[model samples]
Target: MSLEIRIAASTDAEAACNVLRRSIRECCELDHKNDPAILDAWLGNKTPQMVANWFSSPTNFSLVAVSEGVVVGVALLTGAGKLALCYLLPEARGQGAGKALLARMEEQACSWGVKALQLHSTATGKDFFAQRGYTDAGMVRSPYGVETVFYWKQLDEDTTCPNAPKRKRFCNCNSD
Candidate 1:
């Protein structure tokens, strides 16, 4: 199914939270695994109420992908040019929704004069970001103890860094 991407509304908070929670539980095993602590910490802040708060943030811009009026994906960008969140339901994976979501969010950020963009890529998303031109900024230990890579890209210039150590494991989510 194709997705229509658009700026998210406060009304979309609930559905967006659903997509975020499900994607984390069903699609992020490679990164969070069966660790209850990690999962809890990662999932804790993504409740619908928190999503609404995200929408209310003046410096945070968000987008949602809808298919037949149901939200299936979400991407959030902060005023600091951080790609704060990017997720899609497992079924929506590989349908180009992920790419479209990121592209639209990136376009919006660029239009806002964002010169650079950065995100912390879980082991599950390093290659996905790498393939889309993000550079490795090294490993960061999350509060949950997950060691993930920080990725950054210069939107105003062509700068690439591909020679970082490969993640020890791969994710099914990134496969075709």
Candidate 2:
């Protein structure tokens, strides 16, 4: 089945939280290493309530990828140009969900006049972000003791809108 990407709503809190937790626990074995302590710390704040607050925040733009009526991916970008969250179910990887979500985030940042975006990527997501033009700024340890790669990307003045089925200028862009 095809994937549908759209803005996240407060109603999506539970499902989005589930996707985040599962993605971290199951797909990020490299980072958590099946350590219960690490897992707990990493997932401690991923509750539905916290996710609902994030979705309701005016300073954040959240997106979810849904497949077969289930949310399979979740991502959030803050107004300060921080990619706060980007997670996908193990089954959702490599199906363009991540790429689409990142592209939309970049476009939103550009619309807000943000020049650069920074994110801490787990081990499993390092290559994925790097391949999408994010460079390693450095390595940092998360609050949970997980080593994460700090990634930075400078967005172009005209960020392409990947949400469209065809590659075209975003609505606000001047058409050629």
Candidate 3:
């Protein structure tokens, strides 16, 4: 089935949060042997209030991929050009939904006049980001005892959307 991409609304908070939680769990399980308590702490810290704050924040932008009315993937962009909370359901992986969601987020960042984008990618997603022109910046150890690789991509000047405003600081709308 073809995936549909759209801007995420406040209504998507629960599904988006679920997707992120699952993604983190799956990725960590595949790569690490961390205890349940650490995993719970890392993913459990986000609450409904935080999700609401993300939706209301001006500096944050979120996008989702839906299939048959169900959200299968999500991505969030922050004012600092950081990409966060990017995830695709286990069933949705390897079917282009992830790439589509990422493209849209990059487009949004470009529209916001962001010069660069950064993210910390899991072992599973590291190659995916590298294939899309992101370079490794460093490695970060998670509180849950997992090590993630940091990556960054500098967008070309010509890729900036003409309609985006020139602003230094904006709202922080990151998820996860």
Model 1 per-residue lDDT at 98:
88
What lDDT does the true structure give each of the candidates?
A: 0.85, 0.90, 0.80
lDDT tens digits, residue span 8-33, model 2: 99999999999999999899999999
Give candidate 3 misplaced runs (Cα > 4 Å).
31-34, 158-176
Error of 3 at 154 (Å): 0.9
In angstroms, the error of model 3 at 155 is 0.5
Residue 141 lDDT, candidate 1, scale 0-100:
89
Root-mean-square deviation of every model: 12.1, 6.1, 8.5
Candidate 2: worst 10 consecutive residues by lDDT? 158-167
Ten-residue stretch with the least lDDT total in model 3: 157-166
Report the error of model 3 at residue 13, Å: 0.9
What TM-score goes with each of the models? 0.86, 0.89, 0.84
Worst 10 contiguous positions by lDDT, candidate 1: 157-166
Order of the predicted models by lDDT, top scorer first: 2, 1, 3
For model 3, residues 1-176, the per-residue Cα lDDT tens digits are: 76899988888888877777777777657545567776776677555557656866888998889998888988889999999768888888898998898888888888877889999888889999999899998999866667889999987654434455545667699867
Q: Model 1 — TM-score against the truth? A: 0.86
Give lDDT tens digits, candidate 1, residues 2-64.
Answer: 579998899999999999999988988988887999999999899899999998899999999
